[model samples]
Target: MRSDLQQILATTDFHSSFDNAVPLMTHLSAVRPNTLIADCGDFFEGTGYYRLGRGVLERDMLLALYDVVAPGNHGWPHYLESELHRITVCANAYGRDGRRLFRPVDVRSIAGRTVAVTGIIGVQAFNAVPYGQRVGQRVTDPALALRELKRAYGQVDAWVVLSHSGFEEDLRLAEACPFLDIVFAGHCHSDAYGPVRIGGVQVLKGYEQGAGFAQARPSESGWEAGAARFADASSLSLPNTLEAVRARITAIARDLREPIDKVRAPYRHTVLDRRLLLEDIATTVYSETSSAVLLNETALRAVQLHGTLTRGDVLAVEPFGNQLVSVNCPERTATSLVSDLSALAGPMVVVPSPLPSPLNAFITTDYLAGALHLPAVPTGRSLAQSVQQALTGGTR
Candidate 1:
């Protein structure tokens, strides 16, 4: 008989996988009794479903899983002091007993050995957010947090970091913190699996949106502990119990999609008007809204220079959920921002070229310079600075 120590099942990028998680959880439970189920991160935000107030969809899904949970970025935005209290109160009410429901770290004893699972939301919440928005949240700094995690090295036989940080940061953490044995990561929607040995530490990203779960066992020589298991959630159809739970969630999402009464104008941007539109959208609007105006300005400049933009393009340019905010900056600060935008527009910056439409003539010379490397330099500035300065005038 195989030694029945502890089995670890973890999922990441579960952006409201609440309904979908039921079947996955049920299957996992049936296969491995008393295993640790962890919802890594992005459980709440970034989906059209949540935008329709379907965060409750995720909340209900988590309620059913009966496992250890940790904070993701999506969960953080909705986190209020009151909500935290309510979550604790409700977990107690639900008769699901464990320190797993809403805690940063949980330690479990299995198969005569203790294991520690430490969950960290990605640093994007800080580095990616616009300036003023990152305030007052108790986020663990990845570098400092790793030091703390090191303290627990000898305390537990296995240390797992359940992270919502993107792949790069997670890999960095895994390399930096040799004490960590496994890292289950999310964000960046990377469908990577297996033991990615980064400086001898094995890191794993279990794909996204509850598509699957990653299972690993510790062997005598670290994570090479034989073949790890990656179970695909899509491979299994809904079981009867899960079918019922899923129906409830689908009905809720369906009901929420009904149109609400709100008066809003349709947003329009055309090739002829895109430069002007981008100028307004970036400097006058987005800059005022977020902390990192330079970042926003770079994105807008890319859009304005290239007349064609897509939803994906917009997202790539501004992935962070930065809102429009303005702070008073002295002329020097504003000047520095202009300089930064100029640097971002240099020849090395490979911007997307617009499709040739009949509307190309309407594009300004400045926009053309950055987009097509046109030699039309405005009287007194570098190619990059001239384009950026011209964009501010709305004439572009």
Candidate 2:
């Protein structure tokens, strides 16, 4: 046991899998009282909790926990509202008034050394977010931000940067910013297996969804790092549970528990194999719009169980908030547009609609349609609503 060595427990892209992550964080904190617990951001999204509260739930929980974090692109849509109890640092994310959203750097005095930590979100994140939602904020180049952060904190015993920037970008930043001692990277969502050294900086990243954290011990030259220990939340004695959070999540689940459809088998999700869940989505969407050439495979987020499917179960399978948008276009044009998704490997299961004409009415997401450069309008029916309608026949 390196009890004499100071440790820093870190995580990244923790999308409020707090049920699993919070306990781990608190446990490590208890064991290493002087340990610095932190996150690399993308924490304000995912799960039912995030959907219900629009980050209020996460903000409250994270702030209550007093975990240090950097901002990720997920919260750029609500920059001002996402600020936590602790100072959020990211040298790149700026305000409409040309000011930094959070502090450019946060210096923490823990154990025997002065540790300065900073954060930066990816600029590409701004492009992914809805244009309307990100009016006031701007994500500048992280490289420039790092330079500014270095200038601000001229000298420190240890310099740690909590980067929401992906691993590749972090590598580039690490090589360029020689002043950095340690970089905790996020957004890419890889465990990294072990830490990597770029130039003189020791970089680390933990697993996604708050499953685990990475521990790094200070070394004479730099730092010794390793893979994140992914621990099952159930394994912990007296596993962490929040009644208030549970009750809220439970209430949402209960509401969505109404039976949708009975499936003979589970709608399993596998990257290599096509999912039956897409067939369900395709059929439901067809029932709603009667549009031909519906595409439902690519946007899928979860898998469904066998037994009776409920709204909750269906939601678990398709968690994204994307709505079903029906648009009219030519069959040639629609097929051509979908084929443009060069990144998609598996064959897209296209379900034909009953509607006829040079106009091929189709269904897709606003974001996806924009990417395909397809002129599509929302029929105002959300993907969830369409599924619910398909299951219940609009009786509800």
Candidate 3:
């Protein structure tokens, strides 16, 4: 009987699920006695107080399961190199004292064969968010870094690319580069589980936030031809180590909640004011700054005008913590960007009646009126312009 090929258990976008580490480690120990576990970046960031210090917590938990780790986009932030290094040092200090904390890639011998694992931090050079707001340090060119991985392919039995570039970019990379045998993706928070063949490459995205894991093994057809599968950790009805972590999170949430003690005047809504506010936020606050805001004032106005605004509604509209960033671009570029935003605008559905509360309504009205009449002047562009172009189809 042929021995089972070495199993590779890969997870990504864990954010800060310190509780997930225990169960994941337990599962790894039981299922694949000699498996290699990898964190494909974005293992940090966007987490609440409960998830804070998760990097250190997870590293300690991985002592019994994981052997390797790769950085993701959320793993680093501006002026936070020390924080990243601190996590690595702490992880190293806890387990395998002599081992290195993070590397571009790790080459290992599994089942009597050599396997190469490469990691690349997703680039923010093309991201629409302001430079200072995007957490985690970014690599300049992910493709170029992957090229280095290609050189080691021939020497390894299997090659895996752990990426945090989301599904679309991963698909594009897989099509453009053929050497990658498997790509584990994160950052899009997509629910697509199981192995998908994209341009002859096996791509897997294991949901998000410690929801599950993806497994891959070599079949009789050989490494390149083997099939892969995904398993949902939550559906597994597995023992819940995450519950303890959730409890801790709940306590933190309660501590964060405090009554708004300030007495404020009752607010009233006005159609003209609402329209102006929406226009101002989208055009002056968002457009004037980020070149590409990925939003529509018409949609916001429609929703608010219909009395459908809610706390959750506001969050969904501006989900990303985007900052206003000024970019210099030629008039043509600015015009094209606006055209792209117009084309991208889609329909919206509002749930309440035809009136709602209005807060700080005047700021918006004045900003919108001023912006609408302002002339479009172009100047030399910056990184923000490049990012806008990338978002608006100026770049692939």
Candidate 4:
């Protein structure tokens, strides 16, 4: 390793996967002495950990480990918390009063070079956040935001973006803002972990959830970037300073492992087939409720299941804790509602796949209903409960 080389360690779309927090922190701890640690966003609100701990665990990890972060749509408000807000940077997002929600930039020294770190949430990604959560918040275009930020803060050695705008958008952003040196991506959850060069910019994403991270090291041309998994860093030991954190995480893990149900056959969750599981869940809900059902694929994370499912496993599958609700939609707008939702949420599975024309109402999760601003009546059900029911074939 060159003594003058700068290194950056980054993670994105963590989505509160506390199950892997300890080891991930251990890896970060080992590299903390020299590396600049940051996250691209969506680090909170995914599993039972977030629901049970109410963001305390995730907040603790960020305070202890990350140097800087971006605000993601999943846990948009958490970024506004006083402590987190200090380290959070989002050049494009604004609050209801038309004031900027966070400071536009954070200037940091990495390997003695002045680097300007900024963040932006893509318009589509911001729209994907539940309507109620973002009632008064809004985000501008990423390219436009970057252009303005560069104009004002062009004195830095390099400009880096912690983007929750998905990868493809970042590629275009790199092209639009050629002055940016690097972009770390989040929110899409796709398999593209590119250190792909666009013009003079490098765009990349870490493995999502708690699987791994991406890093950039100074190179002769510019910077060399790539992804790495926690397993690869497991040999490095964490200093005793983090022992208490590990203990707390261990206790939480024990509680999360409590058995919830049993499955007769294994249902594997993969990138290509996660929506199939959602379709199964939607079908089960449709059968029980005798109503049409709609589900956004992003509402569930990819996790496999077999015999002896645990509470943590179920929560990991439907981490948001969204309630299963029925909402009334006018016949005239029902079709457009699904189409608009699909646009923001990527692919969606609507039970009775054709989505009958003149559809009046349907059963959907609270997140989706809130996204469309529909009045939702609680069915006294949750996506977690429905997932367990679907896997176990029980009504509960």
Candidate closest to the true structure, highest lDDT: 4
Q: Rate the local accuracy (lDDT) of all candidates.
A: 0.48, 0.62, 0.45, 0.83
Task: Report the lDDT tens digits of candidate 2 across residue range 208-227.
Answer: 77776666666675677765
Candidate 4, TM-score vs. the true structure?
0.90
Kindly report which residue stretches of model 3 are placed more than 4 angstroms away from their true locations once superposed: 1-5, 17-33, 50-66, 78-102, 122-130, 133-144, 152-154, 198-200, 223-396
Pairs of residues at least 3 apart in sequence or in different chains that clash in candidate 4? none
Model 2 earns a TM-score of: 0.77
Q: Per-residue alpha-carbon lDDT of model 1 for 163-206, expressed as tens digits? A: 76777777888877877778776665655565678766677766
Which stretches of model 1 miss by more than 4 angstroms?
Answer: 1-5, 17-26, 29-32, 77-104, 127-134, 138-140, 224-245, 256-396
Q: Report the CA-based lDDT of candidate 3 relative to the real structure.
A: 0.45
State how far residue 239 of model 3 sits from its true place (Å).
13
**TM-score, every prediction:** 0.57, 0.77, 0.53, 0.90
Candidate numbers sorted by lDDT from highest down: 4, 2, 1, 3
Stretch of 10 with least lDDT, candidate 2? 265-274
lDDT string, candidate 4, 1-396, tens digits: 224326888899988887677668878887777888889999998888887788887887898888889989888778889999988999999888998999999887776778888999999888877788788888999999889988998789888899999999999999999998999999889999999999999999999988899998766777789998887554566666566666777777888899866764546332324677788888878887888898888888776665677788878777787898998886545568778878867778889877767778899888878877778899998888878777767776
Local accuracy of candidate 3 as per-residue lDDT tens digits, 86-120: 32211111113433334556666656666677765
The 10-residue segment with the lowest total lDDT in model 3: 359-368
Candidate 1, run of 10 with poorest lDDT:
87-96
- For residue 178, what is the lDDT in candidate 2? 80
Cα displacement (Å) at residue 31, model 4: 2.1
